[model samples]
Target: MKKIIEIKDFTKSFGSQTAVDNLSFDVYEGDIFAFLGSNGSGKTTTIRCLLDIYTPDSGTLHLFGRPYEFSMSKDIGYLPEERGIYTRSRVIDLFVYFGNLRGISTKDALDNAHQYLERVGLIEHKDKQVSQLSSGMQQKVQVGLALQHHPRLLLLDEPFKGLDPLNRQLFIEMFKELKEQGVTIVYSTHVIDEAQRLTDRLVIINDGKRKAYGTTEEVRKTHGSEHIHLEFTGKFPKRSELYTSVSTTKTAEIIPNKGVDPEEILQELLASDLRIISFRIDLPSLNEVFIALSKDE
Candidate 1:
């Protein structure tokens, strides 16, 4: 696979505070890569440096195997964390303007704008001023503008912000379609489940440092523990020295202590006269891995 973006030993600082600490990662062509981290954990900082919006203190940021240049702007689509659009401009006009700036002809730009607006369910509001639309609606327009030129690489920062679940799902589907069409996407987000579902590979960062990076299953195995999920009846077992358990109404998630067998825990529960409904041992989820890594000292 060809590398679409590369960052090697990239570091950035503002004043005395370091925003990104010697981070390095590669995004492959046609892969949906995710930058998973909480706010202020360097996800946005790394992206800005990648786009050359800010100069890095050290190391290299490359696009298409070379340093980014103004000429490459037409090949990359970026939706920044900060949302800014011409409030007084009509929605369709904003898209057409950006399309033209990307070097598309007026007729082609208008055609693309109409197609995008319809796809995003905003065609009915094509002539409405941006200010007349709600924040979520405005965000849709911004997304359309980023995509109107049909760039090969798409970079989105906090793309899910201000979106409702339905709209989020819509965008997710749109991304999947783009990926199928050979568009590579790199998005930074704090939403763990969405990242797990959408990305082929991801890097989890905390305090501006990489904590875990791999396929979701690989990260779960590397940074997560094995646990038993139980749906049961009767009084639940009390916390035992052999394991730790978190439970609600009729379900419990039990994590055995190191070297303690899950079978041993199951036998003990059965001996206690608890009617087990169902039980299965599984690796922790990406969310669990993220929480555990974030708490690391």
Candidate 2:
């Protein structure tokens, strides 16, 4: 697969504080890539450097296999973490203006704007002033603007912020459609469930350093473990050398000790007075892997 974006030993600093530390990663063409990290962990800082909003202290940031240039802006769509729009302008007007700036004709821009608005459930509010719409509505408008020009690459920073579950799912479907059409998307977010569902590959950062990076399955297999989930009635079993468990009310998650068989643990539990309702063993979810990787040392 072709490389769409590359960062090599990239580092950045603000005063004496380091924001990103020798980070390196590649985004392949047509990939839905997740730039994941908790707040203040330098996800935004890496993106800013990639777009030249901030200069790197060392190393290279490349787009389309080369350094980014102004001419490339037309082929790249960016939705920054800090969002702002013309509050006094009508919703449709803002799209038209930005679309024109991206070299689209007024007629095409207007048609595209209307199409996007309808898809995002905002066509009814097309003529409303930006200030009149809710924050999520404004976010939808910004999303439309970023996509109006049909760019080859999309960079979205915390794009799901403030969106209700339904609206979030709506946009997730749209992104899937875009990916099917061959758009390469790199979005930074801390929302683990969405990332696990939408991303082809991911990188986790903590304290400005890369902690994990690979295809979703690879990361999970490399850093995650399997555990048993149990639902039962009555008193839970006492702590034993066979396994460690965490439980609440009627459920427990058990991690068997090394060299211990899950069957042995289950037998022990069965011998206890508790009535087991259900039991299943599964690999750790991306959320669990994320928490374990990002935890403070």
lDDT of 1 by residue, 62-123 (tens): 99999988778778889999879999998878877887777778889889888888877889
> What global local distance difference test value does model 2 have?
0.89
Quantify all predictions' global Cα lDDT against the true fold: 0.89, 0.89
Score candidate 1 by TM-score against the native: 0.94
Across residues 1-297, which tens digit of lDDT does each residue of candidate 2 receive?
999999999999999999899999999999999999999999999988888888899989999989887778778889888878899999989988987787778898899888888877899999999999998798788888899788999999998987778768878998999999999999999999989989999999988999899999888888876788999999998666888888998999998888888899889889989899999997777898999997743
- Considering only N, C-alpha and C atoms within 3 Å, which residue pairs clash in candidate 1? none
lDDT of 2 at 200: 99
Model 2 regions lying over 4 Å from their true place: none
Model 1, residue 98: distance off in Å is 1.2
Clashes of 1: 0
